[model samples]
Target: MPGPLLRHVDALVGVGVLVWNLTASQFGELSQQLDQGLDRARDFVTANLPITDAQLDKLVKQTRDGLSGSAPDPVGGARTAAEVFGSILLALVLLFFLLKDGRSMWRWVLRRMTGPNRELTAAAGRAGWRTLGAYSRGTMVVAAIDAIGIGLALVLLRVPLALPLALITFLGGFVPIIGATVAGTIAVLVALAANGPTTALLVLAAVIAVQQIEGNLLEPLVMKRQVQLHPAVILVVVTAGTLVAGIAGAFVSVPIAAVAWRILDTVQRHRAADSA
Candidate 1:
């Protein structure tokens, strides 16, 4: 990665960590509450339900067995961590190599081709890159707007884990239609769990309001000329991507659509010019 891009990525990671720390503190409290509620519910059931001593003893034994069985496996956890870290390392190495040598590599490939086909290929590549770059820049702005607006709203409402939820909302903005909705739902649920129904409702309204503002104002202002896809086209692509490849597809579909559209547009314009 270039220096500026690396700096931006580091900043985003730092923000994520900050949000995680803030929300993790609140998460501890929520965990304790959940444990206490479970204990109370268990006691109430034990007190009210009709059961024999033998049955109760068996149930207790079964519960203990289940708890033991469910205990975390350190070896498995370590293996998973190692796998994740290794993948990240590999990706970084590959990206570094690509960034260092990508232009020469592309030119080498282009040199093997001849005639109009080569020109068309180069044009399509340029258009795709331009489209992707524009989308990335615009999405960053939109994500910032989402994070700030909803984060301030959560803070005003005194919602616990607000920063973490806002961070999630910002990241989710990268995905097309459904990302923010899913993240906002998590925020509302957190509010409901930590506060009360009234607070939860307020959080829900706030989430909706923020999304409305993002869709109507921020996205239009930031991404208006970046991506040329219509609303219906976006919706269809999002739906198809979601259905075919799930969350990952939904996240990437818009960019891929933009690139494809750019390529097509470039081809058409070039052909028209050549004819003229």
Candidate 2:
């Protein structure tokens, strides 16, 4: 709606596109390397495996038939893309509306409630929003640190496509446990392809170190201000969330838990005071 907002959005869109294109190009090269390796492995297996000529021919035919039967569906792909784009557009519109009138909407909702329920609702809303904001900011800081640490490590080791991989790592950090693992694996694979297994192992170590630091130091220090959760509790909730709702649940589980705790604490204190 404003010039500054428009400018910020434009800049972010440009940067996102640039990063995506660079990463996609790197992935294309990586895919080719993977294909070549698979081909070599297949050749070796065929050469060494004990089988009659007719049996080998039958096996190859069966594999080819299976692959052909599982051909990519262009229509399905297009439909999925359209659905995703539509959902994104809808979310942006809703976000804009919320930003424009969120306070008024909240006030109106509060007015409709009565007595203790209204007060409790207001308190819960405040706590929930605060937890969400704190978690969002702290998570970004942690992700930035992770990206920088891993990216610098890659650069020091003379790994190719360090920046693109770092960008991916940063984005992946938002997805919680699975995201970082997948991103780090990609970096290791790239290192293995460009350098060697030795360099790849080194990269793997660096990734593990960075993740440990983030989990042990960065997250606790920053996130404790808003939400103090035991590591075991977090693990259980995260696992449950991932099972229930995939990435979105994993991303939000902690914040939701924190907010719920805050609300319960508030309610308990209110009850204690009323009794006194």
Candidate 3:
């Protein structure tokens, strides 16, 4: 009996660790594109070197027809915000539910397991709290660090829309690989337009280097104490999640995987003990 109890506890503890891992890497999906940069330097050279002054003049018709009466792109700086009104409303609603009733809901789950399964119930609760707390805290910190770093880089580059881009970066950083990749791409693309494709390429390279440092060096140091999973497993889950849930699925795949791993692993170990 004693051995069974200890094993059950061990399994739950492991689950707690898994949850933390998912929470921390939310912004990494976006970071990947940043990692594999756009190779702007090569492109810039190719585009510029191939053309002489006269060729450029011919293309732009000696800058006469090019600048004759061309008005600015009507769509530039077009919308107030790219995020739709509905996303904002949904976020507010989710925040309310989590803040006010999230705890009670877990208590309700624990309450549903009848009879002598009380210990199992408690284990589940521990797993839930660990998942929620670790993911929330880790993701918040990572996103903040990412946003600040990228924002500073953009500022140094004298990129326009720095503040708006920073805010977008912070929000997107919450989504893991895809989020960072998309957000940073936006930054680079915007930079390209504002400065030129060459400058944008440089900005893109900077984003990738920063992400590598964060993932290879910083993440391991910080996450060692949080949750641990093999890299291959994470890749599989991310892929599967994108297939099943699209963006939402991809964003949430880790936490769900963590919880599933925790719950299933816990139950299995306990069952083994019972049979023994």
Candidate 4:
């Protein structure tokens, strides 16, 4: 678990750095576009709304000044960094102990149980573990496919920061439906800002095509056997998890659901066999 999670964190950091560099390199052009967009917005508001040009100008100025304000407090930043580091350290220590003693702990639990109950417990545990493993592998395969498909389209469209965008897509693919949509939207916006409407539309179409293939074809083929949950069920589970616990909940929910389903199935099968 920590292995895959650490890799994800690394990927996220890489994507962030790449995106930051891309944005920095294109800052001048982006600023010009922003100013032009603001001008258009002001014109539209002045023409259609009750607001005066002076009021609009003041609002825009305030917004711009707020955005361009001084950097964040170093002390607060340091405190946040320390907290993050402490959390990571604690996680690593827990991971170490779990890795070292998990099997022994499982055996101890099984030893305390008796007869059919022990057998059922063992079977359910094994099933849940297998399901979780299958989910991890299947998700990675699907994410790779998404990243590759979207990256190729961006390359063909000559979109700037295509690689970083593709990396973002790959990372987003881990979160299932919602992640992919957000990543695609970011790609479309970037294309629109950098390459205009036609290219942005093309990118959007490609994203949709890739996502369709992922959802309708790749997911069913790759994940159905492992997860065994309906698309709607997965969607609902993800949504509930997100509402309850944000990104961490969303990330873990599907695997938890899959494992729980497998465990229940295992227990039911054993019960039926024993009754028969």
Top model number, lDDT: 4
TM-score ranking, best first: 2, 4, 1, 3
129-224 per-residue lDDT for model 2 (tens digits): 788778878888999999999999999999887887898899888766767898898888778777766887899999999999999899889887
Q: Please provide, for model 4 over 125-241, each residue's C-alpha lDDT reduced to its tens digit, 9 standing for 90 to 100.
A: 988988888888889899989989999999999987776677778889878788999889877877776777788789999999999999889988887775878778889999999
Native-to-model Cα distance after best TM-score fit, residue 271 in candidate 4, in Å: 1.2
What's the lDDT for all of these models?
Answer: 0.79, 0.80, 0.67, 0.82
For model 3, the stretches where C-alpha displacement exceeds 4 angstroms are 1-98, 101-105, 229-232, 239-244, 272-276
TM-score of each: 0.71, 0.75, 0.59, 0.71
Model 2: per-residue Cα lDDT at residue 192: 73
lDDT of candidate 3 over 1-276, digit per residue (tens): 256755875795796577445444543532443333334433454577976556654765656675655533546324323333456688768866765677788788768878758777677657655865676567667777777888898899987656566667777765667678888888896776567767787889888987787677766665554454566776788789878755666777877776677666667776778789
TM-score of decoy 3: 0.59
Q: lDDT by residue for model 1 over 1-276, one digit each (tens)?
A: 579967877897897788776777676665554455444445545778886556876988999999889655999769867876796799779877777787888898889889998999898888888889889988988887888888898899997667667777888889866788877877776676666668768988988898898888877877777586887898899888977755656887999999999899899999999999
The CA-based lDDT of model 2 is what?
0.80
- Pick the TM-score winner: 2
Cα lDDT for residue 155, candidate 1: 94
The runs of at least 3 residues in candidate 4 whose Cα sits more than 4 Å from the true structure, single-residue gaps closed, are: 1-88
